[model samples]
Target: MTRLSHSKHNSLDEKDYIETLSQKRNTSKSRKVLEVKSAALAAAKQHGLNPWSKDSLILYMCCFTSFLCSCANGYDSSVMTAINIMPFYQTRFTSGVVGSTTGIIFSVYTIGGLTSPWIAGPITDRFGRRRGMLIGAIVICIGSAVISSSNTKGQFISGRFILGFGVSILTCAAPSYIVEVSPPQWRGRMTGLYNCGYFGGSIPAAAITLGTQKIKSDLSWRLPLIFQCVPAFVVICIVWFMPESPRWLLANKHDEEAHAFITRYHGGGDPSHPVVELEWHDFKEGIATDGADKRWYDYSELYKTTSSRWRFLMVVFMSIFGQFSGNGLGYFNTQIYAAVGYSNYKQFVLNLCSSIVSCIGALCGVAVADRLPRRTVLIAGTFASAVFLAINGALSARWASMPSDAKNLSVGQGAVAAYFLFNIVYSFAYTPLQAVYPVECLQTNARAKGMAMYGVIVNVFGFINQFAGPIALKNIQYNYVFIFVGWDCIETIIWYFFAVETMGKTLEELDEVFTSSYPPRAQIRKVVAIKDDGHVDLVKEA
Candidate 1:
C-alpha cells in the first residue's frame, strides 16, 4: 500500500512539473516578442521614419510613379469606349454591331492578362522585381506604339493583346512590390492610390479624346492611342532610378543589400536598429516556413496546407467576383450614357467628372481601409453598388418598354444617373480594397504565383463582363443590369461569412491569420498583441 501511494505521488509530481515547464516555455516566447518590439520602438525613435514622416512621404511619391503601371490598365480599358465613338476608328473598323467588335477589342486585354501571369510569375521570381517591372514597361510602350500605328482590325486587336500582356505582368509586379516595401500602417492607403492612378490616367484618356474629337484627321483617334506610351515611358525611366524591393532583395540572397535597404528606407539608416531586426525576423520566419524550393514544378505548395488552400480560394474569389460585381459597367459608361442620349462629347465630359468622383471615393477607401474592418468596407461597397445597379436596371427597362419618344424623358435619364452613381460607389468601395485584400491573403513565396493566378481568374470574368455588356445591350437591352444585382447579393453573403480581415498586418504576420483555426463568424477575436507604438497589427482584425 505504501508503494502504491508513493507511485501515485510520483505520477502527480511529474504531471505538475510538465505543466510548469510548458508555462516557462510560453513565457519565454512572450518575453522575446516584447523584447524585439521594445527594441524596434527605441530604434525607430533614434533612426527610422514613422508613419507621418516627411521622408516617408517622399518614398510614397516615388512608389506612386511605379504604381502608374496600373494606370496603363485603367487607361486602356476605358480609352476604347471613348475611341469607339471616333468616326475615323469606326470607318476603318467594324461599323455594324459595334458592340460585338468593341467588346472583343476591350476584352482582349483580359486574354493577355490570362496568359502573361504564367510568364510574369516565374520571371519576377527569377529575375527580381525591378527587372520584371522594366520588362513590362518596355512591352507596354511597344504595344501602345503598335496600337497607334495600326490601320487594320487584326493589327488593332494584336496591339491591345500585347498591351494586356505587359499590363498583366505590371499588375503582378506593382502590387506585390508595394505591399512588400511600404510600412504596415500606410500599406492600405498607398494601395488605395491605385484608383487615383487609374482614374488619373483615365480622365486624360477622355479629355484628350474629347479635345481631339473636332480635329478632322486620323490624329483624332490615333493621338490618344499613342498617348498610352507616355505614362508607361515615364514609369520606365523613373522606376529604374528607385530602389528594388528589400523583401525581394533578401529573398534572392542579396542579404547585405536588403539589410541596408531596410535601414535607409524603412529604419532610417540604422542597420542595428530594432525596426531592422523586427522586419528582418519576419522574412526569416517566412523563409523558414517556406522551406521548399520555389521550383516551377512546386505549384502544389500553394495548397499543401489548409492555410494556403483557404488563402488561395479567398484570392481567387476576390479576383473573379471583382469583375462580375457590375463594376465593369464603369469601363463601358460611355456606351451606357449613349443609351440615354448623352453620347459624344457629353459622355466624355461626364466620364471625366465621374473619374474625379471615383478618385474622391478611392481616397475615402484609403482613409478607412486601414482604420475599418476590411470585410465591412467590402460588404458596404458591394451592397451600395447593388442598390444603384438595381435602380438603373429598373429604370432602363421601363424606358425600353415605353414609346420611342418616352425614352428621352426623366426615367431614361434616371437609368443614366443610376449608372453614374454606381460608378462613384464602385470606385470608392471596390477599387482600393479589391487588389489590397487579395495580395495580403497570399504567402510570400506564392504571392507572384498567387497574383498570376489572380490574373487568370480576374481576366476570365473581365472577358465575360466586357463581352457580355455590349452583347446584352444589343440583345437584352438595359435589363442586363439585373444580372449584377443578383450576383452581388450572393457575393455579399459569401464575403461576409468567409473573407479574412487584413487591415493592419505586416505581410509576414498574415501567414498566421489564415492559418488560425478560428471560425470566420467570431465577432470578438482574442487580442493578439499590442505593440509599444500602439499601432494595430491585427491579422484577422484588419
Candidate 2:
C-alpha cells in the first residue's frame, strides 16, 4: 500500500483512460447498503421468479426480492429514528415507564449486526443465496411480529436483536445474489435501484411514525414495528420462485442449472449463445479449486494468498474510510445545524431536502455506475467529500470564533449548504458503490464469507463513529471536521493505490484483474485475457 505515497493524479491520463476504455471495452453496469445499508437492500425471489415470462422478468424479479428484503433493513435502521421522537413510544410499557434502557434497546441491534456474519457466511455459501435470504426474511418476519406484540421491554429488546440478526444475514446474501444473477452490462443500475429502496424504507418509516404520533394507543409505534415485516415477507414469497444465483449454482456443482440460467436470462433462452458459452468457460478456468479443507471457518483463506490478502484488506480499509468520512454526522446532522446556529425548523427542512437529494444521487449512480470506471467514482467521491468537509469546518470555525451576536450569520448558511452538498455527493458515489467493489473484487468461493467480513468491518466502524461522532460534536464543536478531512484524504490515497477497475467485466473476468501483479492504476484493460475454451492466460492489450 506504500505505493500510494508516490501516486500521482495525472488528469490527462485519467481522461484518456476513461475515453479509450469507453471506446474499446464491452459495456457493463454496477452499494451494498443504505447511508448505512440502503445501497445494499433492494432486489427479488420466487422459484426462477416469474419463470413463465418470456422476457427477463425472472431475473429482475429475483433481484427485486433482494430489494424487498432491504426494506426490512431500511425500516429497522430508521424505526428508532422515529420511535425516539414519539413521546408515546418513550413513555409506555417498561417498568421504568419506558424502555429507557438505552444499552439494551439501542446497542442490541448493533450486537446482532456484528455477530450474525459468522453464521451468515456458511449458510449462504453452503445452502445457496435464495435459501439464506429465505432464512433471513423469516427471522425478520418473526422478529417484527414479536416486537409488535411484545408486552414488556425485554421482549421488545429481544425482538429488536432478532430483527437485527435477520437483517445482517440478508445483507450478506442479498448483495451477493444480486451480483451473481445480474448481467455484466446492466449490473450497476439494477444494484443502484436496490439502494433506492433502502432510502425508500427509511423515508416511509419516519413518515408513518410521524403521521401516527398523536394516536393514543400502543398502535402508534407497534404498527410500524409490524410493518417492517411487509417488505421482509414480500421478499421471502418472491424469492421462493426466483432462480438461485448462477454463479453459486456453478460453484456448488449444479452445472446444468447454472448453464440453463445464463441461457434463459443472460442470453435470452439460447444455450448456444456466445455470451453463455464464454461465461461458462470463464467460470471453469477462473474457479479451478485447490481442494483445500472446506470448513466454515476456512475464512483464513481470505488472507492466505497475496492477492486475496491485499483485496481483503482493501475491502476492510474502504469500509473504515467510509465510516470515518463522517457519514454518521449526516445521520445526526440536526446536531450539526444546532451547533451552527440554525433553528429546528431549518434543520428539519435541510434533513428532508437531503433525503430527496440522496434519492437523486442513487438514481445517478444507477445511470453512470455502469458507464464510468469504479476507481474513478471512488476517488472522485472521497476527494469531493473531503473538500466539502474542509469547507464546512472552515465555516463552523469562523462562526465559533466570532462573538455570540455573529453566531447565526451567513457563515452558518454556508456550512449548511456545504454539508448538504456533501450528503448528495456521498449517495451518488460512496454509499451506493460500496456494495459493488467488494462483491466484484472477490472470487466466487469466498464471496459469501467476504461479504460477511464486509458487514463485520462496517459495524465495527459504525460502532466507533456511533460513539465518537457525538463526543466530537459536544466537546470539540465544529473543528471535528478536520478529523474526517484528514481521514478521507488518507482513504483516497489508499484507494488510488488499490482500486482496480471492475467495470465491464463478468464476475469471473474480475479474477483476471486481482490475480495479476499489475500496479493498481495500470490494472485495467492492460494485461487482457484470451480464453480459448477454458485455457485462461493473459496477453498485453495491443
Candidate 3:
C-alpha cells in the first residue's frame, strides 16, 4: 500500500511538471504575438499621414505637376478623335479619313514614341527627372507649334512624330519621379491620380472640339492642336519648383539632400520620426550607389536577375494588355458611333459625354486604388470590360447594318449605352493602373531602363492599335469588337495567373516579394520591429 501511494504521488508530480511546461510555452507565444501586434500598430500610426497637413499639401503639388504628362497624352488623343470627324479636317488632308491614310496619320505619333525611349532612359538617369520633364515639355511645345501651322500632311505627321517623342520622355520621367517621391501609403492614389489626368485633358479637348467643329476653317483643328502644348507648358513651369525624387538623390550620393527631403515631406520635419527612420533605412538598404540607373547602356540589369526578369515581365504584360483591351478604339470613337447611324453632330455629342463619364470612372478608381488589392481590381475590371464589349458587339451587329429610319431605336440606344459602359469599366480598371503598376513593379536599379522598355512596348503595340484599328473597323465592322472580347478574357486569365499583389508594401519592401522563386505565389513577409533594438526585420508568420 505504501509503494502504491508513492508511485501515484510521483506520477501526479510528473503530470503537474508537464502541464507547467506547456503553460509556459503558451505564455511565451502569446507574449511574442502581442509584441508583434504592438509593433505593427505603432508602425501603422507612424504611416497614418494627414492629407490636410502643410507637408502633405506640398507633396501633392509636386505630384500634380507630374500629372500634366498624362494630361498631354489624353488631350492629343481626344482632339484627334474630334478632328477626324470634322469636314474641314477631311477637306484639308484630302486623304480619305476612313481607310489606310487615316491609320498612317494616327500611327505616326506612336512611331515617334518608339524612337524616344533610348534617349529618354539615358537622359532621365543622367540629368535628373525634373530636367527630363523640362526637355520633353519644351519639345512638345515646339511640336505643337509645327503641327498647328502645318499646311501639308507630311508636315502634320512630322509634327505629331515630334510630339510623340516628347510625350514618351515625359511619361517615363514623370511616373518615376512621382513613385519615388510619394509616401508609400499614398503612392497608389497619387500615381493613379497621375494617369487620371488623362481624363482631365480629354474632357477639355472634347469640349473645345465640340465648340470648334462648327467653324468652317482649319482653325477648328489647329486650335485644339495648339492646346496640346498647354499641359506640357504647365509641367515645365511647375516641375522646376518641385523637389527632386529622394531615391534619385540617394542613388546619386546626395544623402543629406535625400534625408532632408524625406524629413520634410514624409516626417513633417522630424528627423527622428518613425516614418523618416523607416524611409532612411529602406533607402540605405535598397538603393545601390553603382546600380544600372547610373550606367547609360546597361539594359541587362532588367533581365540579369530572376527578380528583375519577373519585374520586367509584369511591365511587358501591362504594356501589351493595357493597349489591346479595346481602349485603343478610343482614338476612333466617332467612327464607332457613326457606324450605328449617328450623324456627325450627334457623334461629337456622344464623344463629349463619353469623355465625361470616363473621367468619373477614373476618379472612382483613384478613390479605391489603395483600398483594394490590385489583382482584385484588375481581374474584376478586365472581365467586366469583356462582358460589355461583347454586348456592344452584338448590339452593333444587329443595328449597325440597318437604315437609320428602319433601325430599332431601342437597340441603337442600347449599343451606345454599351459603348459608354465599356469606357467606364475600362477607365476604372486601366487608367489608374497604367502608370502605377509598371512603376511599382520596377526596382530602383532597373527603374529607368525598365520604364524605357515599357515605353517601347507600349508604343509598339499602340502603333499597331492606331494603325490597324481603322482598317479593321472598315473591313470587319463589329467583328473587330469580338477580337478584344476574346483578348480581354485572355488578359484576365493572365493577370490571374501572373499578376503580383503590390497593394500595401513600400517600394523597398517589394524586394522580398520579387526575389522569391515565383513572385505571384510569394507571401509578403511581415515587417516586424525588434523589441531589443528599435530596428525593423522582415519576419514570416507561422
**Top lDDT prediction, candidate number:** 3
Worst 10 residues of 1 by lDDT: 1-10
Sort by lDDT, best first.
Answer: 3, 1, 2
TM-score top scorer: 3
lDDT accuracy of residue 370 in candidate 1: 70
Candidate 3's C-alpha lDDT? Answer: 0.83
Tens-digit per-residue lDDT, 1-542, candidate 2: 00000012223343453343333334221101112101011111101224456557776786678777667655664566555445567677432211224434655675677889888989998888999899998998888888899888888878878887888799889888888888666677666666567667776775666566567877878888878888888887778788888888877777788888877887667554445544665665555343211468788657878778866876786667656687766545556777788774555455556666766776687678777878888888888889998999999888888899646578988998888788778778865677677777777788889888888887777655554555555578788789889888887887888777777666665554667776374444433222222111222232
Error of 3 at 272 (Å): 1.1
Q: Which stretches of candidate 1 lie over 4 Å from their true place?
A: 1-58, 95-97, 288-293, 519-542
Q: What would the per-residue lDDT of candidate 1 be over residues 103-195, giving only the tens digit for each residue?
A: 888788788878898888887777767777788999999999899999898898899899989988887888878777776556777776754
Higher-ranked by TM-score: 1 or 2: 1
The alpha-carbon deviation from the true structure for residue 496 of candidate 2, after best TM-score superposition, in angstroms, is 1.4
lDDT of 3 by residue, 32-142 (tens): 322232222245454566789988888999878888888888898899999987888888897565679999999999998999999899899888888988999999999
- Model 2 clash tally? 41
In model 3, the Cα lDDT at residue 429 comes to 92
TM-score of each: 0.86, 0.81, 0.91
Off by over 4 Å in 2: 1-53, 92-105, 149-154, 214-220, 288-294, 341-349, 397-410, 524-541
Instruction: Report every candidate's CA lDDT.
Output: 0.72, 0.68, 0.83
